[model samples]
Target: MNLFRLDASILPGASTSAEIADAAEAEWAAAHPDGTVTRRHIGTGFFPSDAWTLATTAGFTPEADHSPAQREAVALGVALAEELRGADAAILAVPLYNFGVSQHFKIWTDLVIAGGGPATPLLKDTPTLLVTTLGGGYGPGTPREGWDHSTPYLERILADVWGADLTVVKRELTLAATTPGMEDLKDLAEQARTRALDAARAAGRALAGV
Candidate 1:
């Protein structure tokens, strides 16, 4: 079995999303001791800002007539798509930034989509686990309810667009402990974090058909 893991956290060591993803990955490692794991840390070395535009433009141009920049962009897209195509399962750890998807993840998704070509779905039916962390509560009845814009957008891209068999494990209130105004919700935040990690472990086990 092969697993491709993408981490989109700027703060790798302090990220709650990364911690949750680690739990899931540990379970997967336990199940398939010999399986290969590929990791992409997009947060640190994010895609170029204009990769999508250049790749899209290249798609319209004949391969023989492409500019050097266009060719590089297209190559990047192809490589990203190949990673997904070659994986049996994938894990994505992303955190909401400014109420939206991380720029790193968005660019990666765009490049992959552009590279997939019109007739092919690189991730068709592939099992994918998405672990996300939000700094504040956005669930129903919360003051910030409906404020989250990242999760739904990610769901659309991974499941609807790429046709992946997807499972999501989410942890909110991640800022409760450290944020000055959220001190009262620290206990609830911890509980949510625990549940999310447990769910991530279960998701990883399921990936091995266990």
Candidate 2:
């Protein structure tokens, strides 16, 4: 079995998303002790900002006329797409950044689409776990209600577009414990964290088919 995990948290040391993902991964690992694991950390291993553009343009140009950069970009897109298609299961740890998807993740997703074609179901029927974290709450009745713009897009890409058998574990108010003026929300943040972690473990087991 093979498990592909992608982490897109810029703060590796203090990423709530990663922490929740860790809980999920640990469960998966326990179930698949001999399984191979593949990792991609876009937060640290960033793609070239222009790579997507080059890859997109290369699709329109003949292979014989492709520039060196375009060829490389095309190869990268294909490789990224292959990672998802090849995986038996996948875990994506992505955090809300500035109320939306970060540039690093956006670039990676675009490159994957460029390589796989918009209609391709790269993860068809694959069990996948999506763990997303938010520093602040944006639920109904919150001051920032309707402000979260990352989760839906991620769901669309991973589940709707890729055709993955998806499970999402979300943790909100992640910064309540540390952010000023959020002292009152710390307890709620902890509760959210605990719930998310528990959900992650269960999802991981399901991903492992255990």
Candidate 3:
């Protein structure tokens, strides 16, 4: 039961999203103490974009290449992708910037997905759990729902690259008013933490087939 925890919280403490991710890891460790856990925190920042080198390696000509720095980029992406593919289960916790995932997560995602890596789709059959936190509200079916591209894009990329189905647990801070409704949102966030932990445990069990 290999567990990979991807934490993308930019803040230091009291980050609701990171908290949820931690809860998930805790549950995984409890369920499989012998299993190893790999934690990748993107909040430390990225190592620049490696799309150019990766593109070149994928058969793109030098005319299409951007810079020589791509060697660094593609190497990092390939390493990360390899790590992701070998893992049995994954947990991604990222805060939604504006209306989507931050550039940090996106960078990692791009590398892990197909066409960016040497082999493509880091993990072709492993299931991934994405726990995302947003600033405002937007559930399943609504007029503004289409504005949300996080889950849909994530699902598409994961399926295309990893051939794995992603279970997205999106936590939107649903407070329209500036004065009130924050407490309610906090409550919801706490529940999300619990849910994340439970989900991680369940994912571990499923991965272990026990």
Q: Enumerate residue pairs that collide in model 1.
A: none
What are the Cα lDDT values of the candidates?
Answer: 0.91, 0.95, 0.65
lDDT score of residue 185 within candidate 2:
96
Write one digit per residue (lDDT tens) for candidate 1, span 97-205.
9999999998898888788774466778998999999999999999989889999999988888788899999999999999999999999999999899889999999
Across residues 16-78, which tens digit of lDDT does each residue of candidate 2 receive? 899999998999999999998899999999898899999999999999999999999999999
Query: Clash pairs of candidate 3?
Result: none
Q: Show where candidate 3 strays beyond 4 Å.
A: 49-68, 113-119, 140-144, 174-201, 207-210
User: Alpha-carbon error at 14 in model 1, in Å?
Assistant: 0.7
lDDT of 3 by residue, 148-185 (tens): 66766666666665666566666666232243646656
Q: Which candidate leads in TM-score?
A: 2
Q: Is candidate 2 or candidate 3 better by TM-score?
A: 2
Q: Kindly indicate the candidate among 1 and 2 with the higher lDDT.
A: 2
Least lDDT summed over 10 consecutive residues: which range in candidate 2?
101-110
In model 1, how large is the Cα lDDT of residue 172? Answer: 96
RMSD of each: 1.1, 0.7, 4.0
Residue-level lDDT for 74 in candidate 2: 96
TM-score of each: 0.97, 0.99, 0.74
